[model samples]
Target: LCLALQDRLEKVEKEVQSLKGENLALKLVLEEKKTFASVVKDGEVEVDSWKVVAASATKCTLKRHSAVDLNNRFSTLSDEIRDCGQTRVMSTVIKTVLLLAPAYVYLYINAVYSLKSSHLHYREPLTDLVSQMQETSTAVQNSTNGGHPSTSVYRALEIDHTKASHSLWSEDAQCSKFLVNFGKNIEGTLLLSFPRSGNTWTRYLLEGATGIFTSSVFNDPSLTKAGFLGEVSSLSHNNTIVTKYHFLQKNHHATDPCILLIRNPIRAIASLWAFKIVTSWDVKHVAVIDNSRYNTSEFRNFYQNMLNRWMDVIRNALENSRLRLLPMYYEQLREDPIKEVRRMLNFLRLKPNEERLVCVARHITGKMKGGQKKFNPYTKNEMNQAQEAVKIVNNLLVKRGLPPLPDYSKYEN
Candidate 1:
């Protein structure tokens, strides 16, 4: 009994020592937390104090104090703060760009629009000034010719056929008083002819009589300089009265009215050859056919091919087209200017004053008249070929109830 009592006293003393050590640690923890005079129990210590837990069935552990790990927590918190700051900066940059982008685009477009408007505003007055200058020059020139006040004055007076007798006979047609069909709501007439068939000379007469410009698919600088202003105009026929077209297949006016101007194939071929020789075959040159090249194998071959082409064009026009055709013979036009001009005007639905008709008669023989060949340029065999082509083409014309071509004796002896 005494030994058991002594053992109990030693155990009580060890527990008292443990309790005293824990009490010191509790005071230290309270001091760190800045707590004054904090009460500690026998078994419990202050917050985050290093201590051991009592366990009977499992292992007990001594845990580290919360305050002791302050350095590690501070390092982790600094990294999180840096990441959050970077994220906020990036978000601000993206939002600023998105908000400003549309404003920048709008400013750029507005600047361009303002510049274009300013340019057009400045350009309009300069155009008007140029046009006024041209009109004034034309008026001054008309005053010098035949005591006419102005071109417009004479034209307006001539349009009123009742007062045309009182109107001054002004030769302004030679000065290319013809107007282009720009913005005019009129369909065009196709003036179809083969090469070297007096197409240019006919155009000069036509424009003089009608006071309207003619156009061509070809941009002939020669004709343009000769006052055919619509030479380089649009091929759509929206800007010209009559368009000269050589190829029948290339005719855009399939259903439109056509004026088929026929000339002797032999004369046309001979004239074309002379033209090629004089102008070096450049279509842009205006050349009168003189006795330049003749009676060669080259001429013979060219005649054969061109004669076939001439026959083919005539055949195609008569066979394929259902449009109203006003066939004009080149020979008949050369014979009488007044009669042919009146007939042509009737066909084209135009009424010209007698004063303009007199002016057209005065300017009948244009500057482009080819030099007359006194003798037949073709050889015996070539003449036969040309005669055969003419016979065939004339028969085709007569069968279609069209006028037969006049005698082709201009090129013949």
Candidate 2:
């Protein structure tokens, strides 16, 4: 019975092993099928995604190409339109010019022939007409002289000096008569002259002489004043009694003293020219006043005109006994400043302050700290021009009953 039991046990073990092996094989087969199915599904999804990406990329490329073509067409259209408009404008301008060509030619010919005939014949009426024409042309040339409104030629011609009489004295002569009254009130006052002259320098000297005053008193604290005249006018009207104005103008109070300061015309012209350069002036439509047709020659003529104007002013001032104009030479101021200052103080009826006189000398010499070097306007060429101008001025001065300028030959060297 034991032998039979052992045999049965061994058979049972073999059956269990066989069953285990079968189960393992089935599990392996199922796993292999699952892996294969998963791989196939993933590959299908990838292929579909790639196809979609390709279709979308192609569509975007086509859209971009269409946009580029549209832009090119628009640009081409714009260029064509611009070209057409330009061509039309050019055609119109050409037609207009052609139509007016004959009229312009006729006018130019008439003007030239008339001018030539007037010059050739000594006909008084024709000469007068020519003069009027010349004046008109000059007015046109200097239309933008001061950047002011252009004065018409017709208006200029119509401006008859006889009809537009300038009164010697106006009803508001109270202000105009200031210098006359000044001589009575102030013991002695210096009458400074020059249209953009070194009136500021004269004021500085006056301030230095007073020593009790500041530079701020002499210099324009607010740049509202046009010039020394304007400043004085304001002060006189405002009743500011600190210091008096050096420069004189029309409509001054009758009670003010007058001390006239004069500079060499050529030097004054050069100084003005330099000032104009640093501060640009209106130069459009400059009149060609030069006899030589060169720019330098024209500048020389302009300088002469300025000198002539200055001479006229000087003569008028000197002749006016009521104004009590005391002429002071710029050269004298430079050479013997202290002596001149004292002389000026005496003329103004003020006692000479020696300390103040010293300060004036120092200020003018630019010896003070932070003082600027004086601007010298004369050059070699300018010196030559000045000599020529002075000769003419000397002749005018003699004619106007004034002494001629001292020989400036010593200064030329």
Q: Please identify model 2 stretches exceeding 4 Å from their true place.
A: 1-190, 212-256, 280-298, 366-404
Clashes of each: 0, 21
RMSD of each: 41.7, 40.4
Stretches > 4 Å off in candidate 1: 1-183, 250-252, 280-292, 410-413
Model 2: per-residue Cα lDDT over 11-125, one tens digit each: 4334433542541111112122233223233112233432233233221111112333433433433233223332142232222222332222122122223332322221222
Models 1 onward score TM values of: 0.54, 0.38
